[model samples]
Target chain A: MISKFTYGEAELVTQLQHRNNQAFTYLYDNYSKALYGVISQIVPDRESADDILQEVFINIWRKIETYDISKGRLFTWMLNIARNAAIDKIRSKSYRNELKNQALPDDVSMLGDQFVKSKADETGLKKVLGKLKKEQRELIELSYFQGFTQEEISKGLNIPLGTVKTRMRSALLQLRSMIEQ
Target chain B: MNIKEYISSGIVQSYVMGLASKEEQAEFEQLCLEYPELVAARNIFELSLEKRAFEDTPHPPAFLKEQFINYINQNTTTNQSKVIQMEPAIPLAQSGSGLRWLAVASVIFLLVSSWLAYRFYNETITLKAELQHTKEAQANLGTRLKILEDYEKMVINPNVAVVNLTPMPEKSPASANIYWDSTTSNVYLIIKNMPKLPSDKQYQLWALIDGKPKDLGLFDIKDDHKVMLKMTDTRKAEAFAITVEKRGNTSGPDMDQLQMMGKTQL
Candidate 1:
C-alpha cells in the first residue's frame, strides 16, 4: 500500500527523476484515474484503454528526464503522453482487427456515453459537455481527446482549416470559463 | 506587441493543446520566455484543462498498480546495467585520440572566436554611426516641433489680429499675412505666396498709422511658409504693406514699389 504522503510538484519531479519508488507510487496514485479517463475517451474499449494507460505510465516513468518544467505543467505533459498512447493504439492495425472481431459499436458518441456511464463515477463532465454547442463539442472531442490534428479535423468535419482552429480555440475558452465558474 | 490581443488570439490555447504548428510553437515558446503574462495565461488554461480531466476521472483496476511496480523494478535493474556498460566504453574512447581531438578543437575555437570578434567590432562601428544619425534627426525634429508650437500659440492668441495683405496691381499674384499683437504691439509677417527675392534684395514691411508709413522690418522670401518673420512693434496701425527693397532696413516704404497692402479692421 502506498503511503498518504503528498509531494509538491518540484519535490515530486526531483524524486521521480531520481527513480524513487515512493514518488512513482504517489504519482500513479494521484494521476492514474485522470489519465485512465482520457485513455478511455479515445480507445473506448476498456481492455485496450487499460493497456494504453499502463503503457502511458511506463513511458512517463522512463521519460521524466525529458520533461521541462519551464515549458509546461507535469499534468499537461502526462496528458499528452496518455493521449498519444491511446491514439496510437486505436490507429494500429491490430486494434482495428480486434475491433472487427468484437463488432464494437460504430458510432463514437454511443460508445463514448456507454463507456463514460460505466466507468466514470461522476456525470458532471458529461453535463458540462452537453452545455456546449454541437460544433464546439465535436471540435473539442476530436482534437483534444481523440488527438486528431487540425487538418484531419477540418477534413473529417467538412470545415475549413481556419474554421477548425478558431472553433477549437473558442471551445477551449468556453470550457475554461465553465470550469472556472 | 499587443500582449492582450496575442493572448486572446487562441495561439496560447493551441499551444497548450499541442495543436499549434511547429513554427507557431517555436514562436510561442520564445514569446512565453520573454513575457511572463503569456506564461500566466498559458497556466490558467492548463489548469482549467486539468480540472476538466479530473471531473471525469475513471479509476483504473487496482491490480494494475502491482503490475506497474513489478515492471519498474525490472526496468530499474536493466537501466543500471545499461549505465554501467556505458561507463567503461567512454574511457576507452577517451584514451585513443582524445588529446589530439582536444588540441584540434582548441585551435579551431581560437580562430573562430577571433573572426567573430572582428565581425563584432565592425558591427559596433556601424551601429554607432547609425545611432549618431538618429540622434541628429531627433534633435532636428525637436527644434522644428518647438517652432511649430510657437506658431500655434501666436495664431491662437485672442489679442492677435490677422491681416491678409492683397497683392498690388503691379505686384499681382504676390500676397502675405501680418499677425499683429494688440497687447504687446509686436508684428509678425508670413509670406503666403511670393517669388524668390534676388540675393541682394529683400522685402520690407511698413505699418500705416493715420496715413503715415512707419518702417517695420526687412525679410527674405523663404521656401518654408511656416517661418514667421518678426517685425518692429507699433502702438497703432491702420494698414500694413510690403515693398521690394535692398537687403537692409529702410526708414519709409516706396509707394511705387509696394508689393502688397491690407487694412486693419480697427
Candidate 2:
C-alpha cells in the first residue's frame, strides 16, 4: 500500500536537489525516526546517534547529486548512506575516545518503549508486520535489528545458509504481496 | 548458476545479508541489471526488512531531527562560502607571484643591460623559462592542495575509523593512522615519518589478531612524501602492523621482520 504522505520519490528528490527546505522537512518527517532507529542500532548511544543524525543529513545534502533512481529507491539509498555513516561514527577514534569502555547509556533504553508507543499509534504498518509468520519475522528481525550478515544469521539461528536464504526470500515475498494487496 | 537456480538458492538473501561470495556478488550485480523484477524484489525485501526494524525501535528524539536539518543548513552555507571564497584566491596568488617575478626580472635587466647583449639576451631567455616553470609548479601545487582537501573530506565521513599506529620500539621510528570504515568494511593506511623503502621492496600492512597476521595490503612510499593509501576488505582487525615485504605480498606475514605495530583500543 502507498504511504499516506504520497509524493513521487523522483519529484521529492528533485525538490531536495534544488535545496527546497519544505521538501527536506517533509522527507525528514517521514523518515527521521526510522533512520534514527537504524542509527541507534548501529551506534547504540543517544549522544552519538544525535551527532550521526546530523552527519547523515549533511552527507545526504552534499551527495544528493549522486542519487540514481535506476539503482534503487531514495529511501534505500539514503538509508544505506545514513546507516554507513552511523556505523563509521562509532568506529571513529574520536567517538571511541569519548565513549571508551562505556556501556550504552540509560536514554537508549527508552528508545524501545518510545518505538513501541509510536508504532502502536502508526498501526497500519504494525498490522502488516504482525501478519508475518514468527520464523519469517524472526529472520527479518535478526538480520535488520542486529545487523547480522546472512552467515551470522545462519549460525545464530542454527539454520543452514541455504535454508536461511529461502526462508528470508519467502518471508520478503509474502510481505511484498501483503503490502501490495 | 542460472538465474532461476540462483534465486531459488537464496543468493538474494545472501545479497541482502551482504555475505555473498565475490563471484556470487558479481553475478548478482549482473542479474540486477538484467532483471528489473529481481531488482524490485531486492528493494521490496530491503524496505520490508527496514520498515520492520524501524517499527521495532523507538522514534528518535524530535530534537535530533530538528538538529539534523539545522546542521544541513549551516553546513551548506559554510561549504558555499568555502567554495566561493577559496576558489579564486589560489589563482590570484599564482598570477600575483608570477607578476612579482616579472617585476624582479625587469629590475635585473635594468642593472645588467650595459654588460653585454649576449648575456642580456641569454638571461632574458632563462628568466622567461623560469617563469614558465614557476607557473607549472603553481598549477601542480593547486591540484595537490585540492587532493589534500579531498582526503580531509574522506576523514570527515562518519563511517571512517581512524586508528593511529605508533612506531615500534625495536624497529624504525615511523608511525601511521589507519582509517577503517566498518560500514564499507575497508581500511586506509596513512603513514607518517616513514623513510623511503629500497627500490625492490614495499611496506605491507598486517592486521594482527591473537598473535597471527592477516595481510591487509602493501604499498611503496612515493618520493613526494605521499604516505596515505586506502586498503580494502578490512574487517575484524584487532591491531595493525607494518613490515618490509617483497615487492608483492606473501600469503603469510614474516613476524621477525615487523617494522611497526599498534593495538587499536579506541
Candidate 3:
C-alpha cells in the first residue's frame, strides 16, 4: 500500500524491521526490475544475473539494519549491495573469462544502451557523465557500472589506485559542477 | 587526514561508488563521523550515482520481481540460521541479527493471531449461552402448557355440572370444592383433590329419598384421583350420600357402605 516515493524513510525502515511481506513485496516490486537491468549489464548472462539478483537481495536483507539514513537513501544502499554481489560473482575465478568477452548481441545490447539514453534524456544522467573526461567515464563505468575493484581497475588500466581514485574524484566533481550549473 | 586533503584525496568518489577497500572504508567512515560536511558530500555523491544507476537500468518485467522476492525470502531463511549468536561484541553492521528480526516478526504475528482467536472464542461462548437460555425458556413454557390443558378439560366437560361446595373444614386454607349434577339419571362424578376412597371397590354416591337409598354411581380412588363417583340416577333425590361398595355397583348400599350424607333441599 505504501508508494515508494510517498512513503517516508523511517516508515520504510520500520516495515523492513518487521519484515512485513507487503513491504518486502513493494520493495522488490519497485526496485527489482531496474536492479535486474543493472545486474544484466554487469553480468551480461541472464542466468547468472538471475542468480546474483537473488544473492543481492539476501545481502540486502542481512545488511539492512546497517543502513544509516543520514548517509544515503535506502535505494542507494540496496543498489550498492546488488552491484557488489554481481561484481563478486564476476570476479570469481571459476567464472570463465569468455563470459566477460560475451558481448550482448547488438539487439539486446543496444536495448540497454537505448534504454539508458531515453532515461538520461529525461533525468540528465548522460549530461552528468558527459561533463566528465573520457578517462573519468571509463573509471566510473568500471567502478560503478562494471563493479570493478580499484585493484582490478588499476591493473586492467595499467594505472595505480591513486590515479584511478583521482580520475574518479574529478569525475564526480565535474558531475556535481554541471548539475549545480 | 586534514579535511582539505581528505576532500581532494579522491577517496570520497570511491566511497560513494562503494569501491573503497576495507581500510579506506574504515577511514572514510571515520571522516564521516568527524565531519558533517563530509557526510553531506557523501550523501550527495551517493545520490547522484544512484540516480545514474537507476537511470541506466531498464524497468524489469513485473514477473521478475516475484521471482526475486521468492528467491530472497528462501535464501534469507537458510542464511539466518548460519549467523553468529553473539551480540554486542560484533558491530551492528557485521552482527548476525537477521533471525532476530524474523523472531520479532513472528511474535507480532502470534499476538495478532491470538487476539483473533480470543475474539472468536468469546463470540462462541456468548452464542452458546443464548442458546441455553432459549432452551430453558422453551422447557418452562412446555410445563405451563400441560397445566393449562388440564384446567381447560375440567371446565369444558358437560356431564359434570360443578356444584360450588365450600370446604367442610379449613384443612386446606385456599381450597374450593365442587359437586356433580346427578339429576340426569346417568353415571357421573367429579372431584378435585379429594381424600382417597377405601378399596374392595370405592366410595359410592347415592341419592336418598326419605332415608332410602337410590343407586347413583360407583367410583374408584387410589391416590388423588379427582373424580369421586358417577351415579346411576339422581331423580327423586333429596339428598346425596357417600357409601362403600364392592368393586362393582350394588343394587342398594349396605350400612358398611355408608360413609357420609348431605341433605339437599332443592
Candidate 4:
C-alpha cells in the first residue's frame, strides 16, 4: 500500500492488469525501495543502477500478463525482474566499457570495499545476522546479492559445489530463524 | 520427496536467488506443485530474501520510479519501441523530487500557452470581419457625398431655371419643385412636402406639353433631402405636375388626383 493511496495486493494485481496509474503508483510506493536494493546490490554503480531500475519496471509492464498468481506473489515476480535487469545491465557493453576504466580485482576484500559503500543498511543486517559467521554472510551475498550461480560461485571462491550448497543452506536457515524471531 | 528434506536442501534459496539450474528448477517446481508445504517454504524464503534486500534500500533515487512509470506507459501504448533515455541518470535521484516539480510546472505552462494562442486566433478573425464591414460602409458614404456635390454645382449654374410648384387648393401642404436647364433640356423633379402614401400607391411625374399630359415616371416621397432625379427629357415644356397613381403604371395622369402643378418660367 502507498501513503497517498493504497490497495490490497490481490485487488492491485487486477487493477494492474487493467493498466491503471494509481495502482502503479501504489506499486512503486510499496515495493520500490526493496526493488532498488536488489538492483543496486547487483549493478554496484549509481547511473547503471538507475537505468536498470527504469528498465525493470518497463519489463514488468510489458510482461505483466505473463505473471501467474498461482506461481508467485507480485513482489516475487518484480524482484526477479529487478535482479534480471541489474544482471543484464552488468552484462551490457556500456556497463563493461565503464568498468574497463576501473581496476577489476578478484578477491572478497576488493568486492566488499566497492559493495560496502551501498551497504549502509547492511550494518543493520549484521545485527540480525550477528550470530552468523563471515563465510555464511559472504555466501548469501554472492548467491543473492551478486546473483551468482552455485557452480559459478564455487568456481569463484575456489571451493567445491557441495560445500557451496551446504554453506548456502546454513546461512538461509539462520536468516529463516531470525525472521521467525 | 520429504518436504522437510527438500526445504533443507537449499534448493528453495537457489530458486529465490535465480541461481538454480534448469533441471533443479523444474524438479523443485514439480515438488512445490505436489506439496503446499514446499510452496509455503518457498514463500518464506522469498520473504526472508526480500528482508535481506531491505538492507541495501538506498531510496533508489526518486527519478528511478518516475522514469520507470514513464517507460511503462510508453511501452504499453506501443508493443515495441527503440529506446528512451531519461537524462542525467546518475545521482540526479538525490534531487529527483525537485525535477518532478519542474516537470509539473512545464505542463501547466504549456496548457496556458495553448489556450492563449487559441484566443488570439479567434480575436484576429473577428477583427478582420469587422474591418471589412467598416470598409463597405465607407464606400457607400463616399458615393452619396459625390452625388450631393454634383447637385450643388448644378443648382448654382446660370442656365438653370428653378420652378416652384403650387399645391392643390384642397391639399395645400403638398408641394414640389422643378429644376429645368433650358440650354441642356435636363428637367428634374423634386417633391418637397408630400405626405406619406399608401404602399399600393406611388406619385407619378407628368410633363404638361402643349396642353397634353405626358407620363414621366414614378418618384418616392421619402428621402427628399438628396439630389433630384432627372424626369422625362424635353426641349420645351409648358408645365410640370405630379399625381397619385397605382404602384405599377397608367397611360394618362389623373387630373382629379393632382398633388401639385408648376409652370416653366420664360
Report lDDT (Cα) of residue A73, candidate 3.
70
lDDT of 1 at A43: 72
List where candidate 3 sits over 4 angstroms from the true fold. A1-5, A93-131, A160-162, A178-181, B1-5, B71-79, B82-266
Task: Output the better candidate (1/4) by TM-score.
Answer: 1
Native contact recovery (fnat) for each candidate is 0.55, 0.35, 0.44, 0.53
> Could you give the C-alpha RMSD of every candidate to the true structure, in order shown?
27.1, 41.3, 12.5, 11.0
lDDT of 4: 0.73
lDDT of 3 by residue, A146-168 (tens): 55566766776678878866777
Clashing pairs in 1: none
Q: Candidate 4 chain B — worst ten consecutive residues by lDDT sum? A: B81-90
Give the range where candidate 3 chain A is weakest over 10 consecutive residues by summed lDDT.
A106-115
What's the TM for model 3? 0.48
Over the stretch A16-59, how does candidate 1's per-residue lDDT look in tens digits? 99999879989998988888887776776889878888878888
The estimated TM-scores of all candidates read 0.53, 0.42, 0.48, 0.53
Q: Which ranking of candidates, highest lDDT first?
A: 1, 4, 2, 3
Better of 3 and 4 by lDDT: 4
Could you report the DockQ of all the candidates, in the order they appear?
0.33, 0.16, 0.28, 0.41
What local lDDT score does residue B94 receive in model 2, on the 0 to 100 scale?
46
- The number of the candidate with the highest TM-score is 1
Q: What is model 4's DockQ versus the real complex? A: 0.41
Score candidate 1 by DockQ. Answer: 0.33
lDDT of 3 by residue, B1-266 (tens): 57877875667766666767889888888778899878877777666666665554555555656776775566556545555353333444345677776787899999999999999999999999999999999999997677566445545666544544333332332222234444454433445544664566666667776667776666666565555343455655566666667778657787654555555545
* Predictions in order: lDDT: 0.79, 0.69, 0.63, 0.73
Worst 10 residues of 1 chain B by lDDT: B83-92
Worst 10 residues of 3 chain B by lDDT: B168-177
